[model samples]
Target: MRQVKHLLADKGSVVHSVSPAAPVIDAIRMMAEHHVGALIVMDGQRLAGIVSERDYARKVVLKGRSSSATPIAEIMTTEVVTVSPEDSVDHCMRLCTERRVRHLPVVDADRVGGVLSIGDLVKAVISEQTEQIEQLQRYIAG
Candidate 1:
């Protein structure tokens, strides 16, 4: 089974993060610049929480809160679900489905490695399936 380490190797383990004390607007801007839906919220080197567009919509826009005035800590999801690089892609998919989350931070021994979005997992699954299908077809032809 393909592991997260392989995925990280393919995708690169560059973690896009924001300080918990940063204004929501800044996080939003960073997400836009990075073309990501979410960002890891870090307090120094430690992972504090996660802030996503969903959080901004539900907590800021819906509540009529000012993005510039609100800190990411106020809207970020503190109880984040995480995975490790050694974990299988299937395990990550299960976690995502069970937790009803779109993003999972890859952490190992308190070190933040990378973040996986649902799209990443889906693409990986599709690629894996395609390879398997091709292999089966070749085997049958031979």
Candidate 2:
């Protein structure tokens, strides 16, 4: 029953973002510098969309488009799937599986708490499983 809040605490609440109006090249640069695969596209205070390396690969490189000339809004995914801080890791895993999304922004009480990636959910699940296995082993020994 691990929640997103627990997960976010493990990682920090550091959200890397860029403006929708920013060039795709800039967003890519920022992501590379931060060593993140995705960047939250912000329109002022609102979460406009998300731009990812996949988007750049498919929408720009594959399409033979110029990254410097294209705006993030043009390549970003606007229908952002989000999760709550109180949401269960199981629920988040289902969302990721069904929606085929790699990342989800965590929203709590009308505010952005953090972002969760598929990798994060998998890590949490694996850790939970490992802990359960250890507990079972201890019980058997006792």
Candidate 3:
């Protein structure tokens, strides 16, 4: 099974984050500009929470909350699920499904490595399956 490290290697460990004190509008802007669904809320290099487009749509829009006035801390999901570099891709796939989370911040040795989206896990799984299928075909052909 492939590991989170493998995915990160292909995707290039890049984590886009915002301060917890930043406005919801800023977070939204960052997400839009970066073409991401979520942002890791940081409190001076520490993971504070995660703010997603869903959070914005549900918490701020539905609730009629002011995006410019609201802080990320207000709507961010605090109890974030995290993964490590060495963790298996299979585990991450399970976590995303069971936890109903779209993004997981990758942490390694007390440092933030990157963020893994559900897409990344799915791609990794597909790639691994393809490799296995190719190997099987090669053996049968021999």
Candidate 4:
């Protein structure tokens, strides 16, 4: 099984974040610009919360809240569950399934390292399985 650190190697450990004081609109723009589904809310160097597309839709749009006027902290998910680079890909999938979250921020020793989405986990698992399958096929053929 592959580790989260290996998966993160291809995708650099750069976390896209916004200040808690930033407006929700700012977060939306950042998400759009980066083509990501979520953004970490940062208070100085500390992780405050995470704002996602679902949060915007459910908290802001559905509630008839204005993005420009509303602070991201108001709609962001505060109690975020994160994963470490040492964790396995299976652990990542389990956390995502159990927590009902698509994205997991990778924290390394109190610092935000990177973010892993469901898609990333899926891709890694598929790649690993493919390699194993190829090895099995070679053994069977030989």
Put down candidate 4 lDDT per residue, 1-142, tens digits, no spaces: 9888998998788899999889999999999999999999999989898999999999999999999999998999999989999999999999999999999999999899999999999999899899999999999999
Model 1, residue 90: displacement in angstroms? 0.3
User: Which tens-of-lDDT digit does each residue in 21-115 have in candidate 3?
Assistant: 89999999999999999999989978999999999999999999999999999999999999999999999989999999999999988788999
The global Cα lDDT (0 to 1) of model 2 is 0.92
| Model 3: pairs clashing at backbone N, Cα or C within 3 Å | none
Candidate 4 regions exceeding 4 Å error are none
Candidate 1 at residue 102, lDDT? 98
Q: Distance (Å) between predicted and true CA of 23, model 2?
A: 0.2
Which 10 successive residues of model 3 have the least lDDT summed? 119-128
lDDT for model 4, on a 0 to 1 scale?
0.94
lDDT of 1 by residue, 1-142 (tens): 7999999999999999999989999999999999999999999999999999999999999999999999999999999999999999999999999999999999999999999999999999999999999999999999
Cα lDDT of model 3 overall? Answer: 0.94
- TM-scores of all models? 0.98, 0.97, 0.97, 0.98
Write down the RMSD of all candidates, one decimal each. Answer: 0.6, 0.8, 0.8, 0.6
- Please write out the lDDT profile of model 2 over residues 97-128, one tens digit for every residue: 99999999997776677889999999999999
Q: How many backbone clashes does candidate 2 have?
A: 0
In model 4, what lDDT does residue 15 have?
Answer: 90
**Residue 89 lDDT (model 3):** 91
Question: How much does candidate 4 score in TM-score?
Answer: 0.98
Clashing residue pairs in candidate 2, if any? none
Q: Return the top candidate by lDDT.
A: 1
Better of 1 and 2 by TM-score: 1
